[model samples]
Target: MGKATGFMEIEREETIERDPNERIKDWKEYSTPFSDDMMKRQGARCMDCGTPFCHIGMEIDGATSGCPVYNLIPEWNDLVYKEQWKEALDRLLKTNNFPEFTGRVCPAPCEGSCTVAISEPAVAIKNIEQAIIDKGFEEGWITPRIPQIRTGKKIAIIGSGPAGLAAADQLNQAGHTVTVYEKADRAGGLLTYGIPNMKLDKDVVARRVKLLEDEGVNFIVNTEIGKDVTGDELKNSNDAVILCTGAQKHRNLPIEGREAKGIHYAMDYLTISTKNLLDKKINNEGLDAAGKDVIVIGGGDTGADCIATALRQGAKSITQFGKHPQLPVKRGSENMWPAYPQVFSLEYAHKEAKAKFGEDVRQYSIQTKKFVMDENGELESLHTIEMKKTRDENGIFVFEEIPGTEKVWPAQLVFIAIGFEGAEDAIIKEFSVSATSKKIDAEYGDFRTNVDGVFAAGDSRRGQSLIVWAINEGREVAHQVDGYLMGESALPSVVNA
Candidate 1:
């Protein structure tokens, strides 16, 4: 630690976000970069605990409790506090391949497990992390580190998302020729489309993609494997193939009036809006929500994004519904230190919604019974029922409808953001890889598939998860692939949990 009592002396600070009222007017990143002094102050809040759970990367209560990438959190925090930005950036990159992305988007479980959080607010780890990498770029410390030697081994990575990108970066560093194929017209997979632009700027993603290209990783966009190219072709041409295709198979709500015209999947709505923006189209390709009442189903980041997107598009009103009850106002006794706290909180999109609408848009314990359409077959309302969790005959928990709680709410557009099921079946079938449910049947920790020299990583291997987890999978799988190629490998595994 830079100063022994730094954590005690300093109070945690976060990056300043643009006024939500003003930010909702446009689709741009809302957080401003912190000043040099602010960055140091935030970094100084890290305690450098004797047993730092911040970077432990363990699974707790069926969810991650710390940084899944095992980021050197305390080391970098202290380095930043000491004004050793270059060293901080170096330490940050030792594990995470893309701090810029994670810093902006990650939920920051590390903060939840921070020792400082037990008594007071946690360290501004995510802000400090972003600051370190941003400073490195500003000072021209970050540059392409092209391998001095070529191993003559070629690897193909399917999907240009975080996982694929991380794996490609690692394998390329090991002197292997890595090529990434993305089905979308642009790289970054869900990063390019699934997330709204206001949260993560597309320019930042483009810049990173260009840097990866400079480092000698070939990216083939709009060329999907098993369609534009065959899986067998990839296996035949490359020494090994790693599938990083994210779990994008969205779960559908097949309720009554499900065929209404105004109903759409959350990804589809988000994707078209982004595509239109990137293509310089003024009308959003006819998916505009201007002057329309909107209701988003499910309660998660994606649901919040829908509300934000609708607001930006000039929606008349927006409401969100969740099947589960609202979380407690504060962390419960059962979820204290070192565990991700289950408490009431508002993310960026929700804040944006509240700012525009003058109230929180969330309505919990409600389930959509059906989509009610108008005479034109366009969604006009939603029939819903309140729910409460209760014990079943087998002592298992289940959601049961509460009688006399049925209600109908007006809505012109509806978005289902209930999350994904798993990877698309078509791609999985094409690869002929064994799978369990929606995920690939790869050995845990080892991302190998049944097919020889074929591996799976990211959401394709693990179900729907955080971008950080996907990056971890990509890096770990690259090690396995590297070892298989050379009979030994020097790439380190990040998963110690």
Candidate 2:
């Protein structure tokens, strides 16, 4: 719906980033703003495909294929191309509660599934999205829309994450009294702590939270339900309770020297680093990575973040271990278009590591055998073995260690970024909610738990997922809760809409 021939005329230009080597010296965001003209050019690249799949918002081959929030990609692109910045921002806010977060961190499955991507590079939807919202903020076009009517129904949301915040926003708009509970001293959950500041600025998160507060959403931080406040108490006080606590129980490496003093979880490291930055504390004590050889286990976004954080902390050297082999430069046969492409590319953190270290820090096809410690039980080094991927009898892929490829590397600190299993057991049991080992027991479309007037959503119910998916569930669950309370709901369902 942009320029009919713009896709063919203009080459795709991505948002530029600050010099990696220069940006690693501080914690500021790496991405630089796109000029309005550049943004318009990028938005003009949207092709007028009869059937656009960029906003389909579905799964294919067990991976997210398009925008999970069901953003109106083409519509927004056309508005942006036509220089209607206000209209573009309106369309953007309709689907996404926080475009700022997704624009910075989301992998942009919409671009992967774009119609133009079948032949050439896709339209810069994510960058254009950021420009729209950033412009809205810059122009003072966005403000708190306090609901004029109150339904007198109270809904208690447990979690200040993307999911919980989105639900609170929607329910508050529907004139329900919404109070969000956060265990952390500050809200925004992972957005505030789990992710490093370089990827997403904490100020951006705080700005949204402040707007929510102005819009009549009550946020009570540093209060953990089931500990500071019992789940039953919340249920008795509120008309409906929605659990948005994310999947936070991290997977651990239970190998040799598991109890080493220098080893820590990636989230713990990131949280401490962010907290120290926010609190203006220079004393990292044992958690700081300065002058130490850092080894990060498990390769993912978290692992990459560890590498970047260690770099910023002035680590001597860094290495990341991954069980899987390196991905192909181009899309593999199994990973077709429309599914998020599994290809080799450097993330911002990886690029920073390379710029600082003069080589990529990631070491693929390597498995950590054990963490070796000194006589005093301090981490000294680690042993690893190269692995080969092979399919088993049932056609399941597995990594097999190559016996002769074992080697040792010196290290003083280690960070485990393996991933998370699911929501913590304590929360599930405290709420009397049924859940499997991996996720809470709730159907996707209907987020009801076993308890009456209770609901669940986001990573806690869907396992570890994208920020956009969390927002989607939050919006959907608000619709469900509103309908349950009033026997009808005017809130839009992301899935059904």
Candidate 2: count of backbone clashes, pairs at least 3 residues apart or interchain: 0
Task: Give lDDT per model, in order.
Answer: 0.89, 0.93
**For model 1, how does the per-residue alpha-carbon lDDT over 1-497 read when each residue is reduced to its tens digit?**
64678778987776699999999888889899889888888887777578889988888877789998999899998998889899999999999999999999999999999998888888999998888888888999988888999999999999999999999999999999999999899999988898889888898898889999999999998897777999999999999999899998999999899999888898899999988878888666446889999999989999888888899999999999988889997788878768888889988888888888899999999989988877989888989999998889998789989999999899888889999999899888998998888899997578899999999999988899999999999999999999999998889875422
Q: Please list all clashing residue pairs in model 1, or write none if there are none.
A: none
Quote model 1's TM-score. Answer: 0.98
Q: Name the candidate that leads on TM-score.
A: 2
Where does the lowest 10-residue lDDT sum fall in candidate 2?
A: 488-497
In model 2, the runs with Cα more than 4 Å from the true position are none
Residue 295, candidate 1: how far off, in angstroms? Answer: 0.6
User: What TM-score does each of the candidates earn?
Assistant: 0.98, 0.99
